[model samples]
Target: MNLNNIHNVYFIGIGGIGMSALARYFYVNKKHVVGYDKTQTNITNGLIDLGIEVHFEDSIKNIDSKFLNSNNTLVVYTPAVPNTHSELNFFLSKGFYVLKRSQVLGLITENTFCLAVAGTHGKTTTTSILGHLMNECNVPVTAFLGGISENYNSNLILNGTDVSVVEADEFDRSFLTLSPDLACITSMDADHLDIYGDASELEKSFKDFSKKIKPNGKLFVKNGLPLTGITYGIEDDSDYSIHNIKIENGTYIFDVKTPKTVLENLQFNLPGRHNLSNALIALAMAVQYGCPHRQLAKALASYKGVKRRFTYHIKTQNLVFIDDYAHHPEEINAVYQAVREMYPNKKVLAIFQPHLYSRTKDFADDFAISLAQFDELLLLDIYPARELPIDGVTSEWLLNKVNNKNKRLVSKDELLLEIHKTSANVILTIGAGDIGEEVKHIKKELSIAS
Candidate 1:
C-alpha cells in the first residue's frame, strides 16, 4: 500500500483536530480531498473554504462519487467513530483501502524522521512547541498536531520534508502505530479507561511505545516517569533541567542546565509549571535533533501556545479569562495551580464541563478535590463525546462530592446567566468537549460586561 498511489482521500471524521490536519495535508498535496463529519465545525469550515468538500450527515449517499474507486481512493476513519457508522460501513463494505487515523499517520511518517510526543496530558502543547522550535530554526519539517497552534492558526504545520513532529496520542494506544525516530512521553496517567480499563495497562502501553523508537534514536521522558530516557524537569536532577525560575510580568525567567551547558535568563510566556516542563522537553528534543540552543530558546519564548490549551480569551489587569482543554483531574489541577500562582488570592471562578461520563465516574474523587481549589465553581453536565450516559454519573453527582459551598451544577443555557451572577476577577473555563464551542460566547459576554 503505497501512499503515492492514492489520488483521493476521504476521511470519515474529518472535523476532528487530528483528522482535519490530515485532510489539510492531503488537500495541500494536491489530492482530491473530501470527507464527512457529524457536525460543521471551524475546522471543517476551514477545509471547505480551501475547496475541500465535507458533509455533516452520516448517510452513505453523502459520499461523493469521486471517492468510490477502490484503486485510487483511500478512506480514513478515527477510532472515535463507532462501528455502526453508516459511511464507515459503506467504505468497509466496498473494500476501500480503509485505515485508522493513527495508521495513516504512521504510514505517512514512516519514511520521515519523526519526533512524536506522547502523554495523557501536555501532548498538544509539547508538540506545538517542538513544531515551532524546528520551524523557527529553519529545519525542513512538517508537524501534525492535535491542537491548532496559535502561531500557525492550524494543526498542520508544513515547513519541509526532512522531519515530522506529531502528537503521539494514547487514546486507543494509537501512538504505538507510529515508528518514531525520536519520542517523548511527558506523562503516563490513567485515561481512556474505556479502552485500557486500568492504569497498569496504560503504563505498559507507554513502555511498548518507547520500544517502537527507531534504532539509535533517542527517547525523552519527564523526570520520575517509569520509562528510562533523557530526563527533564524544573529545578530537579535530570539530564535536562531548568532552575532560577521566576515569573516576571507573567513570563518565566529561568536558566536551563543541559548536559552541554547552562543557558540563563530564558523567557517563556505560557503559565503553569506543567507547561514550563513541557517547554523544557520540547527544547531538549530540538537540541537533541541538533537545533541551536539560542534559537530553540528564542522559539520557545515566542510560542503563543495551542489555541484551547490555556488560551487567553481576555487578559486585563482588572479581569482575566482563560479557556483550557483540561479534561482529566491532573489537567484540572494544573489549571487551578497556574491560576492560583498567577493571580493569588483573587476570586477564581471555574466553569467546568465534564468531558465523558466514564471519565467523570472513574475520577470523581480526584475531580472533586481539584475543583474545590477554585473559589467558585459552575459545573455543567457531562459532555458524552462517544459514550452513552453511565448510570449515577452526572454533574450533580460530581458536584455533591466537590466539598465546596460555592459549587453548583448548571446547564449551558444558564451558563451565561450564572457567570454574570458572579463578581469574580479571574475566570477559567476548563474541559475537553463541546465546552470549547462555548468559548466564543463566553468571551463575548465577558467583553461586553467589561
Candidate 2:
C-alpha cells in the first residue's frame, strides 16, 4: 500500500486504545480520519478534539462520503468488532481495502527499525519506556503504544522516523504479521483462551512471535519464560537484571547488570518488581538499538508510567488508591504484590471486575487465591466484552470462591456508596473492562473522604 498517497483513513472501532493511536497518527498527518465506535469515550473525545470525525453508530450512513471511495481510503478495523458489524460488512462488501490495525502497522513500520514488544502483559509499559528511552537518547523514533503514556499524554510518540516502536499484540495472532529488528516477551501468561483454547496454544503463538525477530536482532525474555532469548529479571542472573533494589521515599532505586556492562543506581518512579523487570527489558532493548546507557538510565527515572497500569489515584501519607487493568489472575497477583509492597502497614481493599466469561471460568480458583490477599474485596459483575454470559461463571461464583471474609458483589452505584462507607486506607480497583470508567468517579469520591 502506498501510504503517502492515501488521504483518508477510517476505523471501524475508533474508541479502542490502539485504534485511537492510529487515528491520532493519521489525523496529525493531515489525513481525513473518521471512524465508527459503538460508544464514545475519553479516547473518542480526544480524537474529536484533534479534528477527527468520530461517530457512535455502526450504520453505513455514519461513514463519511470521502471515506467511501475504495481507492484512496484505507479501512482499519479492530478484531474485537463483531463479524456482522454493519460498518465493517459494508466496507467488505463494497470491495474497499480493509486492513486490521496490525496489518496497517506492519505495512507502516516495514521500512523502519521496528522494536516490537510482545507478551500477555507489560507490553504497554515496556513499549512506552522504550519509546521514551529512544527519544531521550536523541534517536529519531516513532512509537505506537497500547496505552496513553503519562509523559506524552498520547499513545503514539512521533519523532523523526528512523526507528519505530510498537506493541506487538498477541490477540488474533497480530504480532506474527510484523518482522521486528528487535523484540521482547515480557510475559507468557495464559490469556485470551477464547482465541487460543489453552495455555499451551498461547505459548505456541508467543514462540512463533519470538522467531519473527530479525536475523541479527536480539530477543529479550523475562527470566524462566520458556524462550531462548537474552533474559531479564530482578535478583536473578540473566542477560539483564535489576539488583540491589531499595525504596527511598516511595521510589524504586536499583542497579541493572547488562551483557556488556552494569548500569548502577537506576531509579524507577513506578512501584512493583514487575515494573523493574519491565524497565530493565526496555533499557536492554533501547541500549541494543544504540541508545547510550547513561541516557537510558536517566530516562528510566523520569518515565512516568502508562495509565491504568499501577496508576496512583490517591497517594497521601495515610491513603493510597491504585487503578489497574489486571483482569487475569496472574496479573491480579502482581497488582496485589505491588500494592502490598507499597503500603505494607495499611489495610488493602480490592475491587475487581472480572473481564470475560471464559477467562473467569478457566482461572476461577486462581482468581480466588489472588483476591484473597486483600483485606476487603468488592466484586462487580463480569464485564463480558465479547462473550455472552456463560453458565456457572458469574461474578457471584467467583466471589464465593474468594477466601477473604469481607467480600461482596456490588454494582457500580452501590460500589460508590459502599466505598464511601469503608475505612480501608489502601484501595485498588482492578479489571480490564468498563470498570476503568468508574475509576475517575471513585477517585474523586475517595479524595473527598480522605
Candidate 3:
C-alpha cells in the first residue's frame, strides 16, 4: 500500500517502542497521527508533546472521527494487542485498511536501501549502533529502532529517507515481511517458544529472512550461527573480527580486523563482550556499505547506548546501580557476565521481574541458573504481558530452583525495603517488564542513602 495515499494514520497500541517509532515517522512525514493505547507511558507522553493525539481508553469514542474514513486512513496494530481489542475490532469490522506494525514497516522501507537487524537478542543495540554510525557518517538514513537511543533521545532517527535502518523482529516471524538490502543476524537462540514451539522453527525463520535480502545484497551473521554469510566475532579469525581488546578507564580500546585491513585503536564505551560483539557487527556492516573506517570509528565511539540496555542510573565510588532489559535466560547470562567483569569485587544484588508466564515456564531451569549467579536476589511476580498465568509457573517456583541462599520472593511494594537490607555494593534491576518503572525510585533512594 502507498503511504502517500493515506491521509490519517492510527495506531492501536501506539505506546509500544516499535509502534511509537512508526507513529513518529508518520507524524514527521506530515500525516495526521492519532492512536490509542491501553496505558499511558513516557513514550505516549513524548508523542503527546509532539502534538500527536493519544488516549488510554479502548472504546470507539476515544478515536477521532477523521480516522474513521476507510479510504484515506491507515490502521496499524501491534501483534501484542489481543484479537478482542475494541479499537482493532472496530477497524476490522468497518473494513478499514489495516496492517500489523511489521507490515507497515516493510512497506515504508521496501523502496529505500533497508538495513535490517534480526536476532532473538542484540537487535535493539546493534540497530541503534548502526543507525548512529550511518547517520553520523552523513548517510541519508531513517532508522526505526526498538529502543530509544540515548544519543538522539528518540527511537526514530530522522536524518533523511534514502536509507532505512530497522530491527527485523523475530516474534510472530515479523521480520519475514521486509526485503532488506543489507541484513545481519546477531543470534538465533531458542526464544519465543510459545510462538515457534521449538528452536528449529525459529532457526528456520531466520533462514527465510536471509533469503528476503534483495538481489546483490549482503548478509552478515555472527561467526558461529548456522548460516552462510560474512561472519563477525571477537578475538577470532572471522571475516570481520575485533582483536587486541583492552579496557582502560571503562572504555574498550580494540582493533577491528576487516576482510581488507586492520583498523586500530577504535574506542567504544558500552560495557560487556556482547556489546563489543554488537559494535563489531555494526562496524562490519558500515564498512561493507562503503562508509570510511575513520568516520565509522568516531561514530561508534560517540554512541551513548540505547536506554535500558545496561543503563546506569547511579555510578559512584561507593554504590553502582544499573538497569537492563534482560528477560530471556541468555540475556540474563550476558548481564551477569558484564556485571561480574566490570565489578569483580563488589557484592551485586539483582532484582528481577520475570516477563511472561509462557517464557518463564519454558526456561525456568535456565533462568534459575542464571539468576543464582548473583550475590543476592529479589524475585518479583511474573509480569503477564500477553499471556495468562500458567498453573505451575510462578516466580516462587522459579525462585525455589535458584541455588543462591540469599534469594527470596518479594513484592513490588516491598522491593525497596528488601533492597535496602542488602549490603551489596552493586544494585541491578533486571527484566523486560515493569521492573524498569522502578529504576528512578531506586536510584533516588540509593543516591540519598549513599
Write down the TM-score for model 1: 0.99
**Per-model TM-score on C-alpha atoms:** 0.99, 0.98, 0.99
Question: Candidate 3: lDDT over CA atoms?
Answer: 0.94
Q: Mind giving the per-residue lDDT tens digits that candidate 1 earns over 1-450? A: 899999999999999999999999998889999889999989999999999999988897887778779999999999889999998888899999999999999999999999999999899999999999999999999999999999999998999878999999888889889989999999888988989999999999999999999999999999999888999998989999999999999999999999989988999999999999999999999989999988887887889999989889899988999999999999999998888889996899999999999999999999999999888999999999999999999999999999899988899999999999998999999998899889999999999999
RMSD of each: 0.9, 1.1, 0.7
Query: For each candidate, what is the lDDT?
Result: 0.92, 0.89, 0.94
Off by over 4 Å in 1: none
Q: Candidate 2, residues 1-450: lDDT per residue as tens digits?
A: 899988989998999999999998888788989988889899999999888888887788887678768988899999989999998988899988899999999988889999999999889989999999998888888899999999999999998777999999999899999999999999888888889998999999999998888898888888899999888888988888888999998899888888888888888998887887788889989878777777777888899999999999888888888999888888888898888888888899899999999999989999999999999999999998888999888999998888888988899889899997678998899999998899989888887877
Local lDDT at 204 for model 2: 98
Model 2 scores a C-alpha lDDT of 0.89
Winner on lDDT (2 vs 3)? 3
The number of the candidate with the highest TM-score is 3
Q: For candidate 3, write residues 3-91 as lDDT tens digits.
A: 88999999999999999999999999999999999888899999999999999889988877797789999999999999999999998
Sort by TM-score, top down from the best: 3, 1, 2
Regarding TM-score, does 1 or 3 come out ahead? Answer: 3
